[model samples]
Structures are given as C-alpha cells and as structure tokens.
Target chain A: MHVFYQPDNKKHFLETDEAHHCIKVLRARPGDELVVTDGRGGVSKGTIVSINPKRVEYQVRDFYQVPLPDYRIHMAICPTRKAERNEWMVEKMTELGVHKIQFVISEHTHRETMKRVLNPERLIRVALSAMKQSQQFHLPEFAYFLNLDTYLGQVEAKERYIAYVASEDIPRHLIQQLSPVRPVEILIGPEGDFSTAEIEAAQAADFKPVSLGDTRLRTETAAVVACHSAVLAQIQ
Target chain B: MHVFYQPDNKKHFLETDEAHHCIKVLRARPGDELVVTDGRGGVSKGTIVSINPKRVEYQVRDFYQVPLPDYRIHMAICPTRKAERNEWMVEKMTELGVHKIQFVISEHTHRETMKRVLNPERLIRVALSAMKQSQQFHLPEFAYFLNLDTYLGQVEAKERYIAYVASEDIPRHLIQQLSPVRPVEILIGPEGDFSTAEIEAAQAADFKPVSLGDTRLRTETAAVVACHSAVLAQIQ
Candidate 1:
C-alpha cells in the first residue's frame, strides 16, 4: 500500500501535497487503495472516492495504531557548517526512528552563535519526507537551533550520553554501557569536539561519556551511529 | 597535527590538491611538520623541503603503517536515484571504516540497468576527503557498479549478511549473530527492497538475513546502518 501524508483526514481528503502527488504525479484515481497517516499514530486504510482538483477524497475503510518505539531516542548534536549534511542526518535519523532532534551550538560548532541562518522549515520538510518514505506513522520532532547550555538545561531523559572519540585509555564504547529499552538522550559534538569545560559540565549534568569507536566520525555520522546503536541495544 | 592526502608522495611532493591546500590554504612553511597519507597503508611524518608552483616538496622523517580494520566490512548496496545521497554514503562509509563499496543492480533497484549513471571518481574524492578529515590512514576501495549475480559470484568473505526490513517472523538482528573481529560482506537493498527471488537467491548462497530495525530505511540509510552494525558487531 502506498503511504500518503494527510495530517488531518477528518474531512476524508488528502493534504495539498498529497493531493498534488495523487492527482498529477501518481495519477492515483478512484478505487485505488491508499494507506494514509496523520503524522501521529493514526494510520488509515482507504480507497480514493474522488480525484478533485482541491483534494483527493477517500473513504476510510480501516484504521490501525502503531505505538511509539519501546525506547525513545532523542538526539541533539552540533550542526555542521554544511547544511546538506545536517539535513541528511535529520532524514536518516527519522528513518532510524529517532524521537527528537535539537540543534546544539557547542563551543566548537561551525557558526558558534545565533548569527547563523538555519532553515527549520527545510529540516521539517526533510523529516516529513523521510517519515513517509520509511512508512513510519509519526514524524520526529525538530527543535530550533539553540546553545549547548540551553539545551542541556532543558533536556530530560532517563539516560543521557555524549559520544566521543575513544583513545586507547577510553574504557567503554557506547555499546558496552547501554541499558536496554529506556528513554535516552545522546549528544554528538562538532568536528573540533566538545571542549574540556563542556565535557565537564555534561558530566555534571549526569551525561556519561560514551565512545562510538576508534575512528573519528563526522558529526552527522556519529549522530546516526549513536541513534542506531541505541536502537540496536533496545533490540538486544 | 593536520592530516593531508598525497596518494603517491613518490617524488617527496604533495599531490597538486594537497600542495595547494598545504601551502596556499594552510600556509605551511619550510620547517613545519606534517602528517600525510598515501591513501593506502603508508603514513609519513615529514618536514617541508621546498614550495614550488605545482607541488610542495617534503622530506620524510618517519613512516608509520596503519593496519586495516580487524574486520573488513565490504558493503554492497543499491544506489539511490539521488546522487547526493549516494555520495553522502560513500563519505560516511569511509569515515566508519568500510573497506569497499559495490553498487549492486538488484531486482527492485531503481534504474536497474544501463540507464543509471554512477561516478566512481566522485565517490573516491569523497573517501579521500573523509579519510583526511577523520585522520585515518587508509582509504576505502570504491568498486564499479555491477549486477547482483556477478557480485554474489565474486565476493569472498568469512561471513555474509543481507540487511532487510523485518516483519512478524523475522528471526534475528545482525548484531545477535555476529562473531567478533571477522571480515564480513553485507548487502543492502534499494528503496523498494529486495525482490523475493533476490532474497531467496541470497539465502541460497548462505547470506544470512538480518534486520536493521522494524522501521523501513532508505537505500543509503540502510547501507550506512548496515556498515556501522557490522563494525559494531566486530567490536563485540
């Protein structure tokens, strides 16, 4: 079944983007089966009733609910200087079932201040596209860019970690310390990494230091790896 | 120490791109020390000898060999329609220490045949840049695009897996079945996923079916997740 996004199906119609896609792009007509989501947990199985210019109307036949993931993975990371890389991370994280993304400005981040222009709408678009493509019922929440201090103060989860490059003396990789199926938050640093003071503060804030591996990963890669690793641990 | 790529460094000189970056961009002088790699296993600690228009000469003071990863991760994945996504995977797989990438033309793959245009050079450039940025000594190999049958026939590894979207009866996650520190080859399907015949054929060839997660992932996202999972399993 082709999954379409219609945040509100109360009127039994596809959203504007879905309408455009069904009518013009996909040529979906009456009697075609469609699986549509409200971008929450509501999934409806329906057949197109009409292909109107304004909206493709559908008759709901059935509905199913997909519960949220067993463990919530909230990932906050420093945005890279390259916007595409950050966007790519958002898309991949959505596919991997991340719950939330908060753009953090650590001491070593690319722009280092509020002066940088960040298009939150673009990130939202990327997340929505990825959620639909992955057949996921819910979209991950995207928070606007904020400083590390603000993010640290506001974030809440059962377990928190900061993924860092592991040197020889670094005792445990993230995999070694994980407790399965719990709400967790992971922080990924910029290319220059978290400064000593930042690390110390994170430590004080109850975030344990976890290592991804010996190889130095890019900010986005680290974020995705951390996300997947956390999910994999849940499965274990 | 800044890491630069001089794939050959044969004449005691940086490659043109590296030379320009080292001298023009980085402004290195005669006495400055530099760590450079030949994109193979050879890493050199050197001191600048001369600055010329075409190249920067450096005298090698010491050489260090970077052994390849304990477990070689040869990832064969179907390429997506978007070129940037494919390029992003190449860069990321490089950072994560994937040894090789083979673009397979799977049954469900988009542009399954001759219509697809793939640039191996662009991927190689991505790998080189990632290798330097990650401060890794070796560059991953980028293979030309090939058909799945040919890939199945030619690949030699101690272990093999095919990452698939799991349904109700899916038996195992990849992490559960892995033996530490063994070279492995993994295959990731396209956005449409592997055809039943393709999956059966792979199983016939002894490639274990593994699930990345419950949520469906994109071609590039699955590829990266598979690469990282294989590495993580090896870390076990």
Candidate 2:
C-alpha cells in the first residue's frame, strides 16, 4: 500500500494538500486502501471513503504505533548549495537511519546564507519519502539552521564526535571507539573543513576525533558516511 | 598545479586533446610545473617546454612509481542510465581506492543491450580525475563490459562476495567475515536487482553472501558503500 505523510493528526480527515495529491495525482478513489504516517511513529491504515478533485477523505481501518530507535543519531552539518548533493545526503542518511538532521553554519562553510527555500518542511518530506521507500518506521527530525558552536553547546548527547581528515594519529577503530551507552552527536565539517580553532574548541568540549576512512570525501558524502558508520557501530 | 592524464607513457608526450586543454583551456605557459599521472602507478613531475596550441610539450623533471595496494578490490556493477549517477559512483569508489571496475549485464538490468555510448572510457576518466583530486598514487584498472555469469565464473579471487538485500541468513559482518585475501571481487546488481536464478548461480560459483548495511540503498550508493567497507576491512 502507498503511504502518505500527515504530521498533524488532529482532524481525522486528510488535509486538502494530501487530499488533492491522493485524488488528482494518484487517482485514488473510494474503497482504495493506503497508509499514512504521522511522522511521529504513528501509522494509520485507511480506506478512501470520499474522493473529489479538491478534497479526499479516508476512514481509518487499522493503526500501528511503532517506537523510535533507542539511540538518536543527530548529524549537524553545513549545507551545500547544490540542492541535489544535499538531497542525496538526506535520502541516503535517512535510509541509514539517523534520528535528526541540523544544518549549521561553520567558520569556513561555503554558503554563508541560503534563502531558506529548502526549509525543514521540505527536508522532512524527503525523509518521509525515503523512509516509506526504504520500509523504515522512524522519521528523523529536521531543523532549519543554526551556528556550529551554538548548536554544539546545546546538544546533550552522551557521546559526541567530530569527523575530520586529520594528519595526526586519530583513533582508527571506528566501531570500538564510539560508546553505545547513549545518543550520539556527530559534527561533519564542510569542504574547507573545520578551522583549527573550531577543532580545538570541539576537542575542549569533549568531542572525540574519529576518522571515517583514508579517502578525502566530499562534505555531503562524508556526512552520510559518518552517519552510516555511527549507525553500524551502535547496532553492532 | 593542474594535472592531466596521459595513459600511454611510451609516447612520452601529451596528446593533442590534453595539449589543447593544457594550453588553451588552462592557459598554461612554458616553464610552468605540473604533475601528471599515467593512470597506472606512474607519477611524474613535468615542466611545460612548449606552449604551442596544437602540440604542447612537457619535459619530465622527476618520476616516481608508487606500489599498488596489497589487496585488490574489483567491483562488477550494472551501469545505471543516468550518467551522473554512474559517474558519481566511479569517482567515489575510486577515491575509496577500488582496484578494478567491471560493468556487467544482469538479468533484470534495464539497459540490456549495452550501448557503446556509455563507454568505459568516461568512467575511467572519472576515476582518474577522482584519483588526482584525492591525491592517490595508484589508478584503478578499468574493465570493459561483460555478461554477469560469464564474468563471475572467469575471475578467480581469493575471496568473492555478492551484495544481495533479500538474503536473511547472510553474515552481517562485512569486513570481519573476509579473509585477508590478495584479490577480492564484489558483484552489485542493477536498480531492479538480479533475478533469483542469478543469485543462485553466483552462490554456486563460490560467492559468499554479504550485507552492506541495514538500509536498502540505490545502486550507486550500494556500490560505493561496498567499496568503502571492503577497503576499510583490508586496511584493518
């Protein structure tokens, strides 16, 4: 069954936006069954009861409340202007099962400011689309924008890591290094990378330096890789 | 310094195509120093000797032959139609240090008749570009198109594996399961995936089943992930 996303579940009726999509775009009609996810672990199975060009209604047949993962993997990264790169990262990371995404501004980040065109809503939509496509139950939280230092200080993960290409002797053990005792917050820098002072500041705040691999990965690719590495470590 | 590819070292001269790029596009002048790689293990430092638009020449200043990695990772993947997707996979897998790339035709592969348009040359160029960008010493071997079962049966690797999403009893240990073999071959299917019979045939040919991650990744993403996982395992 095709699944739709409706974050708000107050009305017990499909909103006009999703309704038009179901009726007009998908040609969904009365008696057709589909699933709707509330983006908060609530999934509802519904059969279309009313269908119109403007509005479509469905009656709930069954519901399942799936619990979110215990470990929250929050990746705070600098956004790349190329929408496709950022979109690719979002899709792949969602499939890898990240708990949240926070786009932040760093000292050497390429794009200082964006039009907020691809806001949290659109990112959440992408996450939902990937989630449904990948048969995943949880949806990651999305945030608009934040400064690196400010966001870093706000996050309260039991274990924090900063993934960077360091010339020094960093911990090579990816799986064993990360502590699975609590949630993880991993900060991935942009192409120019985190400045020296930024790295020092993070280290001062107890963020361990972890290596993804030997290769020099793009900002978006590194983010996805780090997210996957963390997920694999925790699950293992 | 701008780098250009010269696949044939015996010529000891830049080809007309690359000469045009060096003199016209890059505006390189005589006495300018740059690095050139033969896309093998040959790395050379050269100084521009002539700035002629048609036949620019570079005098070799110094040369170094880097040793290849102990372990060889060859990935035989079904090429995707979107050139960018295949190009991205080639670049990322090269950066992650893949040794060989073989484009194969699978049973359910969309592009059944491999067109000459999607040649391995472009993929090779992308890999070389990625190698130069990542400052890697050795360039991967580029293999031509091949049929699935025929190619799988011909290559004899110390260790061989196929990434299949459906197998439940497959080992989750990615790099840990493999022996420290010299050469490894990994087969990645197309977007539609290999048919059931194809999987059985591979199993019969002594290919072990391996899982990349828990998520259902796209073709290119899966290839890169497998490349990284296998390379990291060898490094460990």
Candidate 3:
C-alpha cells in the first residue's frame, strides 16, 4: 500500500497537492487501499472513498501506532550552500533513524543565513520520501532554523558529542564510552568548521569532543557519518 | 603547495596533461614548490624549471616513499546512473582510505551496459582531488569497467565479503569480526542487487555475507558505508 502524508488527518484530508498525486499521478481510485502517515508516528490504513482531480478523500479503516526508537538522536548541523549536500544528509539521517534534525547557524557557515535559499518544507519532504523508500514507519521531527547558541541551549539529550577536527584525541572509545541506553545529540560543524568560540561554547555545555575518523569530511558527509556511527554504537 | 599527478615522474619530467595544467591552469613559475605523486607509493617535491605549455618541466628536489597500509581494501561496486553518486562514493572512500576501486557489471544492475558516459580520466582526476582534499599523499588505483565474475576471481584477498540483503542464518558480524586481518576485498551489488546465482557463485568461492546496517541504502551510500565500516573495524 502506498503511504501518503497528512499531518492533520483528523481535521482535514490530504490536500490538493497530495490528492493530485494520489488521483492523477498514481491513478488511485475509489476503494484503493493506501496508508497515510501524519509524520508524527501516526499511521492509518485508509480506502479511497472519493477520487477527483482536485480532491481525493479516504476513509480510515485501521490505525496503527508505531513506537519511536527508545534512544532518540537529535542532530544540529551547520547548513552547506550546496543543496544536494544538505538533501543527502537529511535523506541519510532519516534512513538511519534520527529523531530530530535542526539546521543551526554557525560562525563560519558558508551561507550566513538560509532564510531565502532553502525550503525547510522541501527538506521535510525529502526526509519523508527517504522514510518511505527505506520502509521506515516513524518520521523524524524537522526544525527550520536555529542559531548555534539557541540550539545548544534547547538540546535535551542524555549524552551530547560534538565532532571537531582539531581535537587531539581520536575518540577511540566512541562505542564503549557512550551510554547505550541514553539519548544522544551530535553536532556537526560546517565546511570551515566550528569557530573557536563556538567550540568553546559547545565544550562549556558539557559536549564531549568526538572524532568521526582520521580523514577530513565535508559538512554533510560528516553529519551522515556521525549519525550512523552513533546509531551503530547504540545498537551494539 | 599544489599537488600534481605524474605517473612517470622518473622517466619523463612531464605528462602532457600535467604539464598543461601546471603551465596554463596553475601558471606555475620557476622555483615554485609543488608536490607530485606517482599514484603508487612515490611522492616527490619538485620545483618548476620551465613553463612550456605543452611540455612544462619540473626537477624533483626531494623524494619520499609512503608505505601502503597493512590491510588493503578493494571495493568492487556497480556504477550508479547518477554520476554524483559515483563521485561521492569515490570521495568518501578516499577519505576512509581504500587501496583500490573497481567498477563492475552486475546481472541486475540498472545500468546493464557501461556506455562510457563519464571519462575514465575524470574518475582518476576526482580520486586525485579527493586525495589532496583529504590530505592523503597516496592515490588509489582505479579499475574501470570489469565483469563481476572475472573481477571477483582476480582478487586474491585472504578474506572476501559480499554485502547482500538476503534471508539467511548468517550472523551479523561487523568488519571487526575479521580481526587480525590482511588483504580484504568487499563486493557491493548494484541498486537491484546481485542475482541469486551471483551470490551462490561468490559463496562457492568462499565469500562471506555481511550486513552494513539495518536500513536499506542506495548503491553509492552502501559502498561508502562498507568502506568506512571496514576501515574503522580494521583500525580499531
């Protein structure tokens, strides 16, 4: 069954955008079975009741609740100008089972501000697409914009780590050091990396400095690598 | 210091392309310091002697031999339709430090026949760029357009693993499972994945099945993940 997104399923049906996709693009008709997700862990099985070019209505037949992972992963990443890099990061993070994603403004971030360029909705869409592609039922929360300090103060993970290139230690005990039972928050810097003050602030916030690997990686690649490493460590 | 690729640094002072890049693109002048690599294990510090557009000459000042890693990793993967995916794989693999890369033709490969879309030279150039970007002195050997069976048979790694999504009783072992290893070869299937016969033949040849992670990833993503995971397991 094809899954559709309807954040407000109780109040409104899938809007024209999704309705057009269902009725026109997918050729979904009356009585067609499909699944709809609210992108907040609510999944419902529905049968198409009314199909029209402008609107497609579905009657909810069954609703299933999928529990989110016990250990939450919240990533606050510095955005890269190359949209593909950010898009790839969002897609991979969604597949890796992250709980929340926040785009943070950093000191050396290439794009001083992404208010005009990137569409947070589009990125959420990408995450949703990746979730469907990877057969994942749970959807990660997406935050549009937040500065470094604001994001740092808001993070509520049991354990937090920041990936800094200049750190002398190679983080040998990543898997062994982290608490497997607790939630984790990992911060990935930009291409220019976290500024001196930014690193100091992160350190002040009790964020342990962890090294992803020996080699230097781009901002987006580092985000994916860090997320995967954390997930693997937690699972193991 | 700029890095240049000179496969035959000893015999010829300049390769045509390198000479052109040095003279025209870089506009190197006499006494300028540049690092040149033979793409093998040899690196040389050279100074420009002449700035001829076609045959720019450079004299080697100091030569150093970088030893190869104790474990050699050769990943044979099917090329994806998106050139960016292939390029991203190469970059990430370089950062993770792989010995060699081979593009193979698989049975269920979306791109059945390699039509020679991207220039082989361009792939090498990308590897070189990644090597410099990652601050690595050695460039990986690139093997382009090989049949899967022939390529698999040619590799003489002490241990070989095939990454496949199959329902078997194989215990999930991270690359760390192959502790105290030497030469290792990992084969990643295409988007559609390797056919059953291919997996069977690989098993007959003593290839172990390994899983990278729980979530399904794209071809390029899987290749990079396997490469990084293997490197981490080996180093740790």
Candidate 1 lDDT, A79-127, residue by residue in tens: 8777777888888999898999988888876563423535787888888
Give one digit per residue, the lDDT tens place, for model 3 in B1-236. Answer: 45677777585366677777778888778878778887777888877786765776778889998888788888988887777778878887887788899888888654434544435777778888777666677788888777778887888886888887664675475554555347778888887778899999888888888877767777787888788777767645
Show where candidate 1 strays beyond 4 Å: A110-117, A165-171, B108-116, B165-168
In candidate 3, how many Å is residue B183 off?
Answer: 2.4
Q: Is candidate 1 or candidate 3 better by TM-score?
A: 1
Compose the digit string of candidate 2's lDDT tens values, residues A82-194.
67778778887888788888887878654434434345666767787788766676788887567777887888896888887653786665555776646999888876778
Please tell me the interface RMSD, in Å, for model 3.
Answer: 2.0
lDDT by candidate, in order shown: 0.82, 0.76, 0.77
Which structure among the candidates has the greatest TM-score?
1
User: Candidate 3 — what's its lDDT?
Assistant: 0.77
* Model 3 agreement with the true structure over A1-236: per-residue lDDT tens digits: 45788877584366766787887778887888888887777888878888766877888988877777678888888888777778888988887788888888887764535764457878878888888766677788888667799888888885988886776557753444567757899888887778889999998998888877666777787888777777777656
Instruction: Please give the TM-score that candidate 3 achieves against the real structure.
Output: 0.85
**Interface RMSDs of all predictions?**
0.9, 2.1, 2.0
What TM-score fits each model?
0.94, 0.86, 0.85
Question: Which structure is stronger by lDDT: 2 or 3?
Answer: 3
DockQ scores for all predicted structures = 0.83, 0.46, 0.49
- Looking at model 3, the pairs that clash are none
